[model samples]
Each structure stands twice: as structure tokens, then as C-alpha cells.
Target chain A: MKVDPRGQRFAAAITTVVLAAVLVSASPWLLALQAVVFAVGAGAGVRHSPYGLLYARFVRPRLAPPGELEDAAPPRFAQAVGLAFSLVGLAGYLFVGAWLGIAATAAALLAAFLNAAFGFCLGCEVYLGVRRLLPAGRAA
Target chain B: MAPEQVAGGAAAAAVLVLGTVLALVLRRRSGRFRAARSRGVVSAADEAAEGLRLTAEDIGAPLGERATLLQFSTAFCQPCRATRRVLAEAGALVPGVAHVEIDAESHLGLVRRLGILRTPTVLVLDARGAISTRASGQPRKADVIAALGRAVQ
Candidate 1:
């Protein structure tokens, strides 16, 4: 399965735009918009089209060496990290106020942008780091 | 800077540093330190017959006058696609050579039994149904032809 890099770029662009709109609008309506965008993007990713299937199946595997196959998928960790960031940001917004939440969100968005642009998976790196610190048997 | 703002900035910085350090330490300690092994090519005879559980009857039954070439592939395997193309071309070149592609995902148990850890594996069997050569990763055209020649000889 061959992955078209352009497809990934397009998906990232859509995710960024939707997320930005949600943050700027800061309204209940924005949540609905975000949900719609996410659903459409995820649906497209899973579509049977050649590019979509290729992106879903082959893109991430090509990132590593041939023999060093990933023991587990990376997206699961990315989702966990994303959820943690969202919760922390929400807490900061509710308790510390809008400015702090905005700052944290901006920082996170910047990091995500850099990662997508440069192919530097910060979340994966962090996950590997944490895995290393765990006692041998506990680490996955 | 206001005293309160300074405190806040310092706190955020502390959190960031702590998070990064913890992540790094954890990753390092999580896995066993294992050195990589060499990618040594295996001849047909060198392959463990018991582990493979693949006999001449199983492979030879499908091959009608033409020799049989079985290729194992994985979903996300780039080299596997390349190998498929190469084997397809080889099949065209050799008289009575047929290529069969197998998805490793559906046959994980077989893969484990064969001790196949990598994708794009090519298995060549002679007309008599004996395994001739087993190449891992993308095999060079010349090497594959040479192996076939040896098997026929």
C-alpha cells in the first residue's frame, strides 16, 4: 500500500482549520461544527478510495526501518495525549481564566503544527520516553 | 514583569521541563536493551522443516509444469510491493513460473510457525516441490534468477 503524502497534508489542513475555528468561536455552536468536521475527516480516511485506504494502512509503517516493526500502533497514544491536553486546557480555562487557557492551547497547537510539518512525532517520543522509565515488565 | 505573572511563567516552565524529563526517563527504562541481529539469507535446506510444516506436497500440488513462487506480504509494507513487481516480472521471464501473493495478516499463525518476522518474503520451490531458496526483504533480480538456476540444476 502506497500512501500519498498530499492526502495527509490535506487532512492536517482540515483538522487545523476546524480546530482554529472552534477555539476562536468559543461557542456551543463551534462544538457541533468541530464534530461534523471530525466525522467527515475520519470518514474520508476510512473510505475505500485508493488514497484513503493507502493513507490508513501504509503511511505510518513506512516511517520506521523495515525490520523494526512497531509492536503497537501510535495513534492510540496520540489520542490519549490529545485528551489529556484538552482536559488540562479546559481546567486552566475554568479555574485560571481565559488568558492562561488560550496560552496553553496556543502552545499545544504550535507544537502539533511543528510535528505535522516536520514529521517529528512529539507524542510518540513522549510515549517512548515514559515507557522507558517504567519497570521492565510494566513497560509495553 | 508583575510578581504574579513571573510566578505563573515560572510554574509553567517547571511543568514543561518536568514533563519532558519524566517522559524521556520512562522511555529509556521501559524496554530491554537488545542488539539487532544480522539479516542473513537462508538457503532452502537451512530453513527449519519442522517449524515451516510446509511440505513438497502442499506447494507442489498447485504448480502444474510451471515452477511456483510464493511471496508473503504485509499491509503497510513498501518493499513488499516492490518485491511483488519484481516477482511478477520474473514469472514473465521464466517459462512456466507462476507467482502467488499471500497476505501475512490473514496467516499470522503460519508466519509465526515459519519464523517469518519480516515482510516481502519470497519462497522458491523446484519442480519436484522442494524449497530452493527463501529470501527476506526485496530480492535482487540477478540473485533470484541465479537461485532458480541452481534449483533447476
Candidate 2:
């Protein structure tokens, strides 16, 4: 199903907050929580994520319906990118040190902030760039 | 705050600032096209109008008589849907202008060849098959009309 672009931005806002918390606290559990959010967004789908639910239930109801709906692949791909980063961050927090986690979460925070504030998708760009390079995935 | 915390905070601040600058630049320049040499299709008389020159075969679609609004979109791009509406309406309002939507995912080679970084990119091509200008993000109706005007004039 097509998704309301605003919903993705809303989800990104929530993620920005969570990622900020992870960076500030250096908490492994918090990074894990973010990882879970990413998993839900990527694996299950954006519509099924908690933030999606929140947007649908609260924010979307209050706002007028979106004029157009966009495909779900890019945002979902973006969610997968977030999942990868958060997992790396969780690993950093658990085994190595808080610094790596902070760094990783900081990266995620940058991307989320871009999406929420500016409406650009850095992760989506990265995915497209990577897709271009991969021989088999070049057509994707 | 701890020294490391201070450093971390500073880094975060820097990222925020950078992202903001990037956003503003992108938003400002989204619908503005630049001078590009098109090897696609253009009559000998219009070589000076080196905008969007594409052969019908190159774009995988027929060119409109007066103008064509070529849009590159991906399934998950939100702005692309909005862009479609603007282009569609603009095309309908103007005589001899057509709107064509191409899925970025399906046309991976085309996207790469064109250096398309984002979705909902609109390419305004004149009747001669030369692209007059192109917009990177959702283009305004006025911009599209203006692009069309530039093309035919």
C-alpha cells in the first residue's frame, strides 16, 4: 500500500528523539530499543510500526488526508538502513565501548534529523547509490 | 558536562547544522534545472537550446507535440506522488504538453545515466525533444508552466 509521506516524517521525528537519547545516555538497552523499532519498521512494514500506528491514530486523524500516497519501498529500505546502523551501535555499546555506540547513534541521529527537519532521505540516497554499484542489484 | 560529553554534544550540533544547510539548499534548488547537453534528440536549428534532448526511444516513450513533462519516481518516495499531481494538472492545462512518469526502481540504468539522486525529478522537454530544464524535487505548477513556456518559445 502507498504511504502518506508525512507518516514517515512523523516516524522519523520519534526516531530522532530515541536516537538522541541513546547518544546522550550511552545505554546499550536504549540502542537495542532503537534496533527493535527499526526492525519493526523494516521487517514488518512502516504501517505496522508503532510510530506508524501513532501517526495513523493521532496525528493523521487530526490532519487532513494526504493528497497523494507514495510507494512503501524506499522508506522501508530506509528503515532497513536504520536497523543496520542501530544493530552496529548496539554491538558497539555491548562489547567494545560506549564511544562506538555514540558514534553510530550519532550517525543515525543525523539521518533522522535530515528526514524530520528537511524532508530529505539520506538513507534512501545511500541505498540508491549502493544499488547502482551492485552488479545484480543495479536494476533495482 | 564531561569532556567527552561536551565533544559528543558538539558533534551532534554540527551534524544538525549541516543537515539544515543541506535541506535549505535542496528545497531551494529542487525544481530549478541547469544547462545540460542532451545527445538524445534535437533538430539542427535548436542545438543552442541544449536542455533536455532525448529521443523517443531513449525515454522509452513518445514525445508530446508541444512539450513533455518527464518525471522520475520511486515507489517509496513521498514527494513523487505530490509531484505527479502537479505535473499531471500542469500538462492537462497546457496544450500539446504530456506528462510521463517513469519508475526510478524499474529504470535503474536510466536513473544512473541521468545522475538522478532523488525521486520526483521532473524533466521538461520541448517539442524538439530537447529538455528545456529539469527539477530535482517536487516542482511547482508555475515552474512547470514556465519551463514549458521556455521550451516552446
Predicted candidate 2 versus true structure: per-residue lDDT over B63-102, tens digit per residue: 9998889998766565776788889888888899878888
TM-score to native of every candidate shown:
0.40, 0.85
The TM-score of the first chain in every model comes to: 0.51, 0.93
Model 2 steric clash pairs: A71-B75, B52-B130, B52-B131, B53-B131
Question: Candidate 1: where is the Cα deviation over 4 Å?
Answer: A1-43, A46-140, B1-61, B64-66
Q: Please name the candidate that would achieve the greatest TM-score relative to the true structure.
A: 2
Which portions of model 2 show Cα errors greater than 4 Å? A4-6, A56-70, A96-99, A136-140, B1-6, B37-52
Candidate 2 lDDT by residue in tens digits, A1-140: 67898998999999988887766666678779878989999999999998999999999989988986778887898899999989888888788776777788788988899999877888776655565566735363
At residue A38, candidate 1 shows an lDDT of 36
Residue A137 C-alpha lDDT in model 1: 44
lDDT of 2 at B76: 57
Candidate fnat values, all: 0.00, 0.39
Across residues A1-140, which tens digit of lDDT does each residue of candidate 1 receive?
22344444434444444444435643324434433433443343323333334555766455553332221223223334544554555555567765555455444444344334443334444442343344444211
lDDT of 2 at A13: 93
